[model samples]
Target: MNEHYNRWLHHRGLDPDLMQELLLLSQDEIEDCFYRHLDFGTAGMRGLLGPGINRMNLYTVRRVTEGLARTLIAQGDDTRKRGVAIAYDSRRFSPEFGAEAAGTLASHSVRVYLYPSLRPTPMLSYAVRHLGAAAGIMITASHNPASYNGYKVYGSDGAQMPPHRVDKILQALAGIDELALPSHSLQDGIASGWIKEIGSEVDTAYYNHVLSLSHENNATANQQLKVIFTPLHGTGNRPVRHILGELGFTQVHTVSAQETPDPDFPTVSAPNPEEHDVFTLALTEAEQYTADIVIGTDPDADRLGLYARNPAGNYTAFNGNQIGALLLHYTLERKAAKGELSSQGIVLKSIVTSEMGRSIASSFGVKMEDTLTGFKYIAEKVDRYEALNTPFLFGYEESYGYLLGSFVRDKDAIQAAMMCCEMAAYYKQAQNLTLTEVLEILYQQHGAYIESIFSFTFQGKKGLEKMSTLMDTLRNQPLKQIADLPIAQVKDYRLGIDHLPKANVLKYLCTDNSWVAIRPSGTEPKIKFYISAVADIIDAAQEKKKRMEKDLRDRLETSL
Candidate 1:
């Protein structure tokens, strides 16, 4: 640790602010910062912003980017000439980091296409496909706290890079030296044509593609419907609002406080749409506008949160499972009615997602598929569907990520927000129903499917060891029941069951189709417990879900 600290201390290019910060660190802080070198995993690197080998800073970004440059060059001349696309969110140093990545690639003689301003991660995915780039980099942490930032890599297919490719990059990365890395100036890269700035052309192309996904040309009847939208101080403001306006929902109201991009994310505790508290400001605006629905997108606009007016004249937030079920029902029903639905059509979801999606798919005579957690897996299945000439109707996860169609290979909040508005508008005008009412009807048709996620954060080095111990305990001693319901099966993903890739996840399935899944977060310091309970009635389902969560938490606590 001292060796690393001394090396960093003497590095000439270290930023002055970082140098001052490093100079004041206590011994423990220094150890924390230099204990181990940061590992570049398949998800790329994510960490709190700081001046350390283990933190996110210029040295770390350059080191991994240097690896990416080498990997791209090794792919041969054509791939290198195809270049890389770069985009960023409105986070602190996002644009700077993006420019740094571009310069690093250019330094290695790799071509680059870079977005001129902040854009959603989905747009980055779209840009990669639209431009035929070999890979892409997005320089923002999705929904993490203001202190956090990250770099995510995407493949030529516009999805997060698969493990095999990432493994090769890791191998190249291991041989690179951070301080000794070389970089070209962003100015020089552009002057010499090694880097090109891209904006309106890609945005227009992506917008047109998104508009094509709507099921109808007749959104006129619902033009009067009131809607509320918030970007949560991220990048969705323009794209989402533009689509909604183009679709004739001109009465849309933006949460004034969160209308513009703010790197500090000052209005909320955190910028995550998955958290209920993040919706406080939006809900307040919803009531003021008497909005039929309230929508919010995370910092990168990759995840969405929703609320709708209920019959009781109050706003209610639906969990990811419920929202996903609603979207699936709306999409499948519309397609089936129009005779566009095919037997070969499929819906993809994570293994941890609600089985209610499967129930909906079965009713429509379509196949339902399950992948491991990340959107990349869903994207992979989309590739398979294309190879087989089947259609991908929809894909979603309980983390509030949803993708419709194949134009964008990752979860797209802009696409989701548009579809959500279209669905709400159609039902509001034609069916005389609220989103809450439609959700209840779906529950009535399919048995009530209730779900919730419990997340436990374990921080620091010791916390990591403790998390490993917890997973080991769960694997060695299986639970037979929770809340008196017998576990009919245990699916341990680490063993690669169900023909899926090996992952560190354990799912317990009850005979009643109720389930609980345990898995650690790949990018954050937390483990999540997903509980799904089904019953004939919503109240009973809710009660069962609550009891199961309590029992599971108690068991996990004792195990620790």
Candidate 2:
């Protein structure tokens, strides 16, 4: 074991107070805690809250912030003067982590604009650009469970720091000799003007930007278009509800059980909007109100999930791909109808996201670009497009993240919520069709696009080794066919040399319009398999989907 891990173990076992707590934990639990330092990846740091070197606590947050501060100082005096913006979600110790980060930056004579209270991740991204800060920090684990918390660093462009710069940050982190809590108080730092508290004004600016995305002014105050919303016990409750009310959405019902920001997230096992369990309360309320649409945002409100009512009154969640495709088509059609579709208008999506978005973009003659998985890549593309005078129309990923305007660099669930409501209304008013009906129309026009995501979780050191072995096996041996489709092309992002601009990923293109991409999650210890197929008819699409899913599962089982 490393010296740090040994010290941590000794502290837990020898310290009387700690021993009392340690006695309750199993051997496996203790081992897990002291196994290794929580990884500080390109996305920054994330882990469970504890006293070990591997945990997320004031000391670890300070260490990372110190590194960021040093990196800024090295850039120049002007960069340091520009400072960093900080925000936190409603997780346990999130506020403390935000304060710790701010105090650490202040100790290095860097200015900090910490949010007055918990704020969404998009707000932190927006504040970075809005204040012209050198960088930004958001203390959130996003959709992770309540036990977990994280620190995400953003660049001056208002996007998460790119991978190349993250390497530099890691190098700086390595140079720090001692990882200890800062001596100075964040409250004192604020009093001395080194740390500033920001609120309402930023909220107004963000809300105004969201309102500007509306295409039509005639929003009929209809109770029949009932909408139900839940924040999943996170920071989105006030902002999402307030935005919906202001947008003339009259019969908007809030999930009372989950309308408050509770770090414990007592209502569900996990606060992730991607999980169906988090929607139990909201779905129940939706049925009672006969809501036309149901929407929920994750802890930091960076991702949005939607459920639409079918003709049989059965409510079903729409996956990220479907939502992305719908938003792309709706935004383009409206822009063209208003004669506002510019020659320079552009749409962005992750490489693993549904290609149906690309097809929709093509139909409107709008440029569509694909970035790597993270929203940071999408934000970087937006920054590049804006610098070149290209108008960014929309950007999304397959993980329930979507961004509408350039006001916020990362995904904004508040904006996505409002836009989805508007899209649902437009579809209803124009064609007397539901959002699902519009989706079917999209399938008929452009061949039906079916996509699915499969994730395999691996934990601890052995799990990491297993994950690496699996990736190596897949890379060395290619699949000849999947579900009767001959594999025609293979894209290995890990062999960055092969692709020139390398990424750690592998993609296979079958002879048919079906494709599969395999890549490890940057923020989590899991490998994701993305399968997509496009067929001429609905029946063919269904058949191909079943076969592809079965083949992928079979291969994954054997390989594992």
Task: Identify the candidate with maximal lDDT.
Answer: 1
Estimate candidate 1's RMSD in Å: 1.2
The 10-residue segment of model 2 with minimum total lDDT is: 10-19
Candidate 1 lDDT, 1-560, residue by residue in tens: 48889988998887899899999988888887887766544356788888888888888888889989899999999988899999999999999899999999987779999999999999999999999999999998889999988999999999998777788888988756788887567998998889999869889999999999898646575586788899999999999999888888878999889998999999987899989898898888788888889999999999999999998889989888878888998899999889999888989999999999998999999999999998889998998888899998999999899999698999999989988888888888888899999988888988999999998899877777888988898899988998879999999999988999999999999999999999988888888899999999999999999999999988877767
lDDT of each: 0.89, 0.84
**Candidate 2 lDDT tens digits, 1-560:** 44564554455224354445545656566677667667765366788776655778766777778889889999999998899999999999999889888988988889988898999999899899889999999999988888889999999989999888887887888746334444467978887788988878987987788788887545683334689999988888888877777778878888989988999999999888778888998998888888889999999999999999877789878889999888888888998999999967989888789888888898888888888878888898899889999999999999999999998999999889988888887777777888888888999999888888888999866788898999888888888888899999888876663323477788888887689899888777888889898798768877888898888888788778
TM-score of 1: 0.98
For residue 82, model 2's alpha carbon misses the true position, in angstroms, by: 1.3
Per-candidate RMSD vs. true structure? 1.2, 2.3
